[model samples]
Structures are given as structure tokens and as C-alpha cells.
Target: MCDMGQWKQSQHFFEHLLNDSNNNNEDLAKVECSLGEVLQWTGEWSEARKYYNRAYDRMMNIKPTRIKDLAYILFNIGEILYLEGKYEEARDYYERALAMQKETYSS
Candidate 1:
């Protein structure tokens, strides 16, 4: 939907899920990630970063962390930086993601 320029719809749906009282941290993280992706596709890089960072921070507190998910968010953030011409910053994010992915597959 986001790829089809349905950002508003995707954002509304994710935001609704994010607002659910019964939602857990993992659920919130997923919603945040989805919102970030939508914003990213819409060329709202800064806003996308904010949502991605929220998801990253929330995931940090989760036990038995999901490395691939973390890597995915990191990769998205890196792409945002890459698009903004912040190559150095983008490299940092990309390297982190690469390491996580390597670990995920190695073990």
C-alpha cells in the first residue's frame, strides 16, 4: 500500500494499531516500523527516522532481541541517510546492520 502511495492509509492503520491499549512493545515496534516505511516512501526522511528510532529504542528493551528486524530498521535508516547525502552517517548504520545480519545468519 505504501509503495502505491497509500501513505495516509497505511499511516492511519499503523497509528491505530499503535494506539491499542493491549498492544505490547513488539507490536508497537512493528507499527512504528511500518509508519517509518510509509513516511520513507513518501519522502519524509526526517519523520521516517523519528519513527524508526522509536522502534529501535523500543526493541532495545525487548528480551531475546530480534536481530533481523533490528537490521531491517537500521538498513532503512541508512537508506534515508544515503538519500540525504550523509554518506558517513549512512555507512555507520549500514555497517551495524551488516554485522547484525551476519550474526543472524552465522549463528
Candidate 2:
């Protein structure tokens, strides 16, 4: 749905998945991240940040923390900040995500 540019449908699907009782923390985190991406695509910066933060929090609570996924969320959050004109904060997040990616890929 997202690949097809169906933002509304993608948002609906992710929201439905988010509310499902079967979702574990990791699943919820991924869904939240996806939903945030949908919101970001629609230019809903604040809402996107909220969902990204939720996803980041959930991802952090899990075991063996997913570095790549965390980096992705961070990068996306940075993009939102950039869009909102928070250049310094956006740069900070982008640097953080880049550092993580470098560390992950280098080793």
C-alpha cells in the first residue's frame, strides 16, 4: 500500500494493525514506524514525530535492540525536523543515525 503511494490506505492498515491484540512490542514498534512514515509523507510533521517517538521508545524496550531500525526511525525523525525548520535538531538526529549506521555497517 505504501509503495503504491496509497497514504490513506497505508495509514488505515497500519492503524488497524496497531490496535490488534496479537501485536507484540516489536510488531507494534514496526507498525508505529510505518504509520509515522505515512504521516510524514503526508506532511504531518508533529503527528509523525509523535509516532516516531513511540516507535523509538518501543524499539528501545526490546531485547538486543535493533540498531538498524533505530537508525531508520532516527533518520526519519530528523527529516521531519528538517521539514519543520529545526535545522540544528535535525542535524543532531541525522548525525546520530549516521553514526549508528556507520558503526553497524563497519563492524
Candidate 3:
């Protein structure tokens, strides 16, 4: 399911998880992040951003321990922005994501 090469199933699973009302914010965030990755790989930039943003929002609602997931979603956001030719914005997001990753790894 982690393979972007088989994104359709990944997309289906994530979407199903997202629609599940019983899912917690952390769970939804994780699945949304995965969905963002699949959408990104499939060249669905806008859809990818939507999922990334949703994941980020959900991550923000959780504890500080969840920031690593936020960073990952930000990285995907950067990737999408880069593909859209928003290099400066993309770089900013990449830098932010990298900084968060460093902080998480260092802790």
C-alpha cells in the first residue's frame, strides 16, 4: 500500500479511511497524507494539495508529537508546488518541512 506505483488502491483505502466517521484525527491525518502522496504521484496536483492541506489541518489539531506528520505533508505540498512551477513557494515549504524533519530526528 505504500507503493505509489499502485496508487489506485492506495487512493481507495485512504478515501475510505477519510470517510470513516469513527476515525480519529491522527488516523485521518495519516491516511490523508498517504492519499496526498498517491494523488501527487498520479499528477493530480490540486487534489494532492487538498489532501495535504486536510492532513496538515488534522495534524495541527493533535499533539506536538504529530508535527512530524505535518512535516511530511508539507513536503508533499512542496512537491506539488514545485510541479506547478511555484519554485519560491515550493522552496519555502521544502525548507519548513526539512527543518521540522531535522527537529523531529534530533529529538
Top lDDT model: 2
lDDT of 3 by residue, 1-107 (tens): 65537778888878888889999888888888888888888899899899889889888989756767788888889989998999999999999999999988897
Residue range 1-107, candidate 1, lDDT tens digits: 77677779998988898889899999899889999999998899999999999999998888899999999999999999999999999999999999999999998
Q: Which stretches of candidate 3 lie over 4 Å from their true place?
A: 2-4
**Taking the candidates one at a time, how many backbone clashes does each contain?**
0, 0, 0
lDDT of 2 by residue, 8-96 (tens): 99999999999899999999999999999999999988999999999999999999979999999999999999998999999999999
TM-score of each model, paired residue for residue:
0.95, 0.96, 0.89
TM-score: which candidate is best? 2
- What value does the lDDT take at residue 40 in candidate 3? 86
Between candidates 1 and 3, the one scoring higher on lDDT is: 1
Cα lDDT, all candidates: 0.94, 0.96, 0.87
Q: After superposition, how far is residue 105 of candidate 1 from its true place, in Å?
A: 0.6
